[model samples]
Target: MYSVVVEANVQYEKESFTIVGLPVVPIKKSKECILSYQHTLGIDITMKKITIHLSPADASPPSQPN
Candidate 1:
C-alpha cells in the first residue's frame, strides 16, 4: 500500500477549480460535494483558482512478477 497526502491552494483568478497529480475518478467527482460544503460554510469561491494536489505525484503500483 502507498501513503498519499492532499494539499490545496486557493488563489484569486477567474472562476475555476482543478485537481491535479493523478487523482482518481471519485476524487474528480468530489467537486460537487466540495462546492456544497463550501456553500454550507458560507464561503463563496466562485471567482478563484482552486487547486488540489495529491503528493507524492508519481506514485505507482509495484510491478508484478513475470
Candidate 2:
C-alpha cells in the first residue's frame, strides 16, 4: 500500500468533491476516503485553492493552501 498525499476540492454550488495530488486512481479513491473520514470522524474538512509537494514528490505530493 502506498500513502499518497491528497488535496481536496469542492465544486462551487454543488457539494461534490475532487482530490488532487495523488495518482489518478488513488486521487479518485480519495473522494470516498476523505468524505468517510470527515463524516464519521466529524472533521469538517473543507477545500480551497492550494499548492502541494510531497516528500519524494513522486511518492506523495504536498499542498500549500492559498
Candidate 3:
C-alpha cells in the first residue's frame, strides 16, 4: 500500500485531489487527467489542493473538491 496526494477535477469547479493509499505513476496520472478535464471541460477552477488514497486495486480519498 501507498499514499499519494494529487490535484484532481471537481463538479465543474477548480481542482481537488485524490489520496492514493497504494499509488503509482499511472494512478497519479489518472488524477492529473481529472484535473485537466476540470480545467478544460469542467467549470472554471484552479485549486491544486487535494489528497488521494489507494487501496487494494483502487484509489479512494476525501470527498469532492474543497
Candidate 4:
C-alpha cells in the first residue's frame, strides 16, 4: 500500500502552475484534469499561480513478485 498527500496553493499575483515533491507521470495529467474541471465551472486559473505538492513522495505501491 502507498499513501500520497496532496496540497494546493493558489496565488493571484502571477500566472504559473507547478507541482512539487513527487515525480509521478499522472501529476502532469492532473493539470489537464484541473483545466477541464475548471472549464466546466467557468473558472479562470490563467492569472493565478498554482502550486501543488505531494508529501511522502518516496512512497510507492507495494509490488508483488511474479
**What would the TM-score be for candidate 2 when compared with the true structure?**
0.43
Badly placed stretches (over 4 Å) of model 4 are 1-5, 55-66
What does candidate 2's lDDT look like per residue over 1-66, in tens digits? Answer: 654443433433533344444467755565666567778987653443323322223553336799
The alpha-carbon RMSD values of the candidates against the true structure, listed in the order shown, are: 7.2, 6.5, 8.6, 8.5
Query: Quick one: best lDDT, which candidate?
Result: 4
Off by over 4 Å in 3: 1-18, 44-48, 54-66
**What's the lDDT for all of these models?**
0.74, 0.49, 0.55, 0.77
Model 1 clash count equals 0
lDDT of 1 by residue, 19-51 (tens): 766558856666666777889999988789999
- TM-score per prediction, in order, is 0.60, 0.43, 0.35, 0.60
Clashes of each: 0, 7, 14, 0
> Per-residue lDDT tens digits of candidate 4, residues 1-66?
567677899999779988776566867776777678879999888789989876574676447999
What does the lDDT come to for candidate 1?
0.74
Worst 10 residues of 2 by lDDT: 48-57
Q: Between 1 and 2, whose lDDT is larger?
A: 1
Worst 10 residues of 3 by lDDT: 4-13
lDDT of 1 at 22: 56
